[model samples]
Target: MFTPRTPRIVAARRLQRRRDRDQTGRFLAEGPQAVREALAADAVLELFATPAAIERYPDLAAQAPELSPVTDDALAALAETVQPQGLVAICEQNDVSIGEALAKEPRLVAVVAEIRDPGNAGTVLRTADAAGAGAVIFAGDAVDPYNGKCVRSSAGSLFHVDVVRSPLSVVDLLQDNGLQVLATSGTGEDDVDSLLDGGHLAPRTAWLFGSEAHGLPADLLSSADRRVRVPIYGGAESLNLAAAAAVCLYASARAQR
Candidate 1:
């Protein structure tokens, strides 16, 4: 028997459904590594690429023969960019309660807010994964965590951690759980290094990273109990949102250990 061909365009309206990951709380996982990790994690592998791209990663095809494969044009259409790495897998987004994130189980978390750049947001997620953060929260109008660049930049790390998007009020709830909310700012009282180097940090801490241009909004900055900065030891006046997140996350990681 033959299967129906995946579309060359794949319908933009259809792709929008993935933004929420509401059905199963899991979103689309794409590219070779991302798809591979999703399948490995038992995430729903809803789609695959044509044999041309499939041939590039024989191992994935072998592992997930059940994929609904489609052509390169189809793959590119489904993907968010021109450089289609030959794979796309949609899965449940995995919804976890905000309290679950601040339980101090992992002892560290990264909170992102108003990050406009998908690449930066994705990069932050990758850093959170590397730093062993328990979760990453995309608060405010941050870029979609499921953006194609983010899914790619994560390098499969996105699969490893719990990612949630919400408002500052939700962040306040995390604070009530004994999770310190440290907002990043150029005008912060002390550098994040000092906060980390002060030789003391709570078992559960949240790093509220801001946007590239505006940093955190005024209200959010005011809402955070503590304000911290990742000081520039060099000529640079500031750090990229992603890079700053990595530093703070790792700092918390080091502190917890």
Candidate 2:
């Protein structure tokens, strides 16, 4: 059994930080679901799990004979949570550039700008995947898609969709790809449902969701082909990033279908 101080465990632990992840071009996928997804994607470079977890997933363990059995303490140390699921996999980063993802001629896309919350970021990716979006792009100062929390929150959907991280103007990139860029704002002029009813939701569209704290930047909002809002009938202030994104993406997906 591997100890907490094992060289591989040490390296895996270092990946908990963004700087180390970037330097090594690797990230940790915790839990059976994430590990299975990473393995299916052929992205898992190494795996660390407790014997119990290994026995629980004997078929998966058989698929990946490189699984390393570790003590529960060692497994907990590799995981980000207080009580880990006794499984973690070291995976190579799956980052794709804006230009590269755009090359696929995606009909629907989700663009995130400066969203700092890793959970929100992962939720958007999961929503986008469920909506059958062609891709999800993290633009400007957005959080890293490979963040441990982000990966965990995605629930393995990260591997199901194409993801791009770019500092370039997302609006320009989508527009250049012959897609209509729709920005979501709380005080926007157009309502999301209205756009859907009006058939203004383009078949080839990219929905832009901004940081929940600041919303979309003025320049970015203005750059969008159009700005739309989710009609809030309730007294609540507004929808958060994930809620707003799910509504917008589903609307577009229904329209495009």
Give Cα-based local distance difference scores for all models: 0.72, 0.88
Tens digits of per-residue lDDT, candidate 1, 107-154, equal 677877878787888888889888888888888777767766777888
TM-score of 2: 0.97
Best by lDDT: 2
Residue-by-residue lDDT tens digits, candidate 2, 107-164: 8999888998999999999999999997999888888999989998888988988899
**Where is the poorest 10-residue window by lDDT in model 2?**
58-67
Show the colliding residue pairs in model 2.
none
RMSD of each: 3.1, 1.1
Error of 1 at 78 (Å): 2.3
Model 1 spans with C-alpha error above 4 angstroms: 1-13, 16-26, 53-56
